[model samples]
Target: MGKEKTKIRLRGHHLFCSNVMDVDGDPIYSARFCANFRKYQQMMADPSQAIEVVCTCGDTCRYCPSWNEQDGKCRLYDYPPNANRIDLEMLEALSLSVGDEITSGELKQRIKGRFGTTLPAMCSWACGFESVLHCSQGQRKL
Candidate 1:
C-alpha cells in the first residue's frame, strides 16, 4: 500500500496554548503553544513534519481573503504549514521531539492545569476577527 498522506489544518495565523508552570515541572503554556519551536529548526526543516489543530471555526477563518466571497468556507486557507494537505509523516516526526510517546497520546494533559493568560487567545481571536472583510468599525470586543 502507498504511504498515507497526513493533512494538517491550520486555520489561524498562529498557534498557542497555555504555558506550564516551572515549579511542578508542568508543561509551560508557551512550551505547549511553541512546542514546535522546541523541536529545533533542523528537525522541522523537512516539510513533512506536521501537527493537527482544530480551528474553532472552519476554513473560512476570518483572516483569509476568500472568507466573505466563499461564506467563511474555503480550501485556500486550509493547509499544512508547508501549504500541503495534512501529512501524518510530518506529525509523526514532530511528535518524536515535541510530544512524548504515549500509546494513548500524552498522558500528562493540561500544563499544570493552571491558566495564566486569558488574553492571548482573545487577542488572537480579535486579530482574526478584524481581518474579516465586513467587520464593522469599533465592533471588536478587544
Candidate 2:
C-alpha cells in the first residue's frame, strides 16, 4: 500500500497569500512559498503547542519587483547594518523568532501589530492578481 499524503491545513492568513503570484506572474500555489507555509502549518497544527515562526518576513516579498536575487535581499527595505533584512524589526517587536513555539492567537496578534492591520488590508496593495474576478472581489476587502 502506498503511504498517505498529508493534507496541509492552512489558516486564514495563509489563505490570503495562497493565491498570490510569483515574479513570472504565475500563481504561487506550488512554489517554495507553499512549501515553507506547509512547514509552519504542520508545526502549528497542535493547538496546545506554541507555533514556531521561521521568519516574520512573509513570502510575498519574493515576488516584488524590488527583490534583489543576487544579494537575497529587498532593495527597498535593506540598508546598512540591516543588510538582507526584511521584517526583522516587526519580528523582534513581536518577540517572535525562529524555533520559538507560540500560540495561533499570539501569532495573529503579533501579525496585526506589525502590519497595523490584517493580511487582507496589506495584500490589497502588494498582491498583483491578474484575474479580474480576483482583483475586483479580492481587493474589495482591502
Candidate 3:
C-alpha cells in the first residue's frame, strides 16, 4: 500500500510574500508564528514540495498574534474581509482559484512571467506592501 502525503496549506498572498519576508529577527510576530513560518520556509527549500493555495486564515494564522482561537479568525480582519481582500487580489492577478495546488518554484515562474519581478501593491495600510509588491491602483487597495 502507498501512503499519500498531506499538502501544505498556504495563504494565497503568502505565495509571494513568503519569498521576500523573513520572520527571523522580527519581534512583532509571536514565537509560534515565527516558528511555523520558518518551518514552511525550510520545507519550501525542496523543489518538489507542493503548497495548497488558500485565501483564508490558514495554518500560519493559527500562530499569528492577531488570531483569536474563540473567534477563529485574525483580529485584524473582520471575518476575513480585510485579509481576504489582499489574498483575493493575489489570486485574481495570478488567475488562480482556491484549492489550486502548486509548487513554490512554479508559482515563482508564473509571477515572473506575469508581473516581471514585481506585482502592484494595493495595500492601503502601512503594512510594508511596497517591499514585495508595487502599487498598481496607486494609493489605495481595492
Q: For this target, which candidate reaches the highest TM-score against the unseen true structure?
A: 3
Runs with alpha carbons beyond 4 Å of true place in candidate 3: 1-3, 78-83, 123-126, 129-142
For residues 2-37, could you state the per-residue lDDT of candidate 1 as single tens digits? 886443333332222111111122132233323442
Put the candidates in TM-score order, highest first. Answer: 3, 2, 1
| Best of the candidates, lDDT | 3
Q: Report the lDDT tens digits of candidate 3 across residue range 1-142.
A: 8776556787767776565455665444667777787787777767667889875666666677777778555566535346577677778887788999988678766666666644447444416545333333221221
Among all windows of ten consecutive residues in candidate 3, which has the lowest summed lDDT? Answer: 133-142
Model 3 pairs whose backbones collide: 120-134, 121-134, 121-135
| Total backbone collisions, model 3 | 3
RMSD of candidates 1 onward, in order? 16.1, 8.1, 5.8
Question: Could you tell me the TM-score of candidate 3?
Answer: 0.74
lDDT of 1 at 75: 49
Q: How many residue pairs clash in each candidate?
A: 18, 3, 3
Candidate 1 lDDT trough over 10 residues, lowest sum:
17-26
lDDT of all predictions: 0.29, 0.42, 0.65
